[model samples]
Target: MSVSSRPDGRRNHPLSRPVDVLERRVRIGIVTVAVLGVPLAGAAAGGAAYEHDRAVAEAQRDQWRRTAAVVVSEVTPGMSRGDLAGDGKAGTAQVRWTAPDGRPATGVAPVPPDADPGDRTHIWVDRQGRVATAPLNDTGVWAGSLAVGVLGAATAAVAGVAAVAGVHCLCEHRRDRAWEREWDAVEPEWSRRPHQGG
Candidate 1:
């Protein structure tokens, strides 16, 4: 009687094939994690930048408020002043005016670019009956925008990394499964085939 040649040439246990496939999948997952590391770092950096910009705006707003008080204390009832000018940073505003006491007074405040001229002007009479001018500074809106931009960029970067990693892992898993199934198909033939006597 003739003996059929084993399809696989070597016998392999059915359970071992599946185990090998699972091991390869675990390796793919590890690689995915490594690939995503760079984006995660970018997300952290973006978050930090957002926080720093927010803190700076807040500090600037507080300083603007103090300057406004000085302006209000220097304005006189009949004193004429030109439109306030911002130093282009932290919404700093400078107003020129003459006090009711006939003294020239200059006050700096924080004012938004769109602030109404009337609202930006404050007249306060000191004990000496001298007028003062107070201007308004609006920095909250700009500060908030800075924070939002930074955070949004960070979120997008992190999400992109996760998506790429997920796709890579899925592809690896599919490939590994196909290889395992091909090996399994030939495995049973090896076990069932007859062995020739030596």
Candidate 2:
């Protein structure tokens, strides 16, 4: 990759054109940033998500509790909050339970799909006596953090690929134009010379 100059002190190789040199540098910088920055951004995103989610989980754990509840109505298939509904098997049920304050509370809770009326099932509730889901466990928190990290990294990688492709497209267009300009300069001189068919 040594560059040579013509008699007029201009670069002799087409690749050494000013625009080409700029494009090459831009490509190297983009690749370097993509390789180093994407992982760092993903790790940062993961750490932020973990810390935020962990804090919320801790608060929820402190304010909520698990208690025994007797189902007052048949637990039918219905959407429940959080990941409970994600599994597609849990159902909603009307339940009765005593709060920590010794006050009776009645609410709908998510129960197993097989729960029937009068069945005793465990449920979680918040301090305000509202039916609630359990706080996220440690594994859930880590999984959420990992998902955020992976998404961030994937997005960055895609952007990097797009940038590289755009740069290459521009370089190709410039090279084509340069070839046309060189041909235009040589065609006249070549046309003046006589050619033998033999």
Candidate 3:
């Protein structure tokens, strides 16, 4: 409701209270960390995640092979689960294909529901020509890395905010105590009462 240009002279500086200055400095420090730390934390986390995912993808690529398979018979899911999985072609089908080692392979894979005999469908297989899940892809690695990066940034921001709040509360407590002590000493003098020993 009111403003004072002249600060109380009891403080170290005529311009401000010590607690106010300390609180301001703490707030600024926390804000700076939140701003600068988020990106740093995000990058560090993202880099680690990227390395881990890329390593996994490399391992999968080395271990799995994608080859074309000819649909020999259908093994449709009763509830349309297989066709709904959406790898372009779906519905389980008995298929024949060649492995990376040039060995003739026969396995069950997903194919179109209307797939007829001899329809070519791609499948992933191991060295033994057994049906296997598709190898991990670069897209998955990027997605995972990005998610980790976001989580890291969020963590940094929350830490920064918590730090600021803790310091603010501590500074407010100190300010209140200082004000109370100062008022106790000054209140009697202003009221023209003799100071009493506490």
Best by lDDT: 2
- From the highest lDDT down, the ranking of the candidates is 2, 3, 1
State each model's CA lDDT, in order.
Answer: 0.49, 0.84, 0.78
Supply every candidate's count of residue pairs whose N, Cα or C atoms clash at under 3 angstroms: 11, 0, 0
* Model 3 C-alpha RMSD to native: 6.2
Q: Estimate the TM-score of every prediction.
A: 0.29, 0.77, 0.63
Model 2 lDDT on a 0 to 1 scale: 0.84
Query: What are the per-residue Cα lDDT tens digits for candidate 3 across 1-198?
Result: 334443653334444687887887789988987899999999999999999988987887798777788988855743233322244455677889887678787866766677888778777777777887666577778888999999999999999988988998898898889888889899998999988757
Report the lDDT of model 2 for residue 55.
98
Candidate 1 lDDT over 50-154, as tens digits, reads 566567655544433321223332223221332222344323344545555566666554444444434444433344433322332344434445556556656
How much is 63 displaced in model 1, in angstroms?
22
Looking at model 2, how many pairs of residues clash?
Answer: 0
Cα error of candidate 2 at position 191, Å: 7.5
lDDT of 3 at 169: 88
Q: Roughly what TM-score does model 1 have, to 2 decimal places?
A: 0.29
Task: Enumerate residue pairs that collide in model 3.
Answer: none
In terms of TM-score, which candidate is strongest? 2
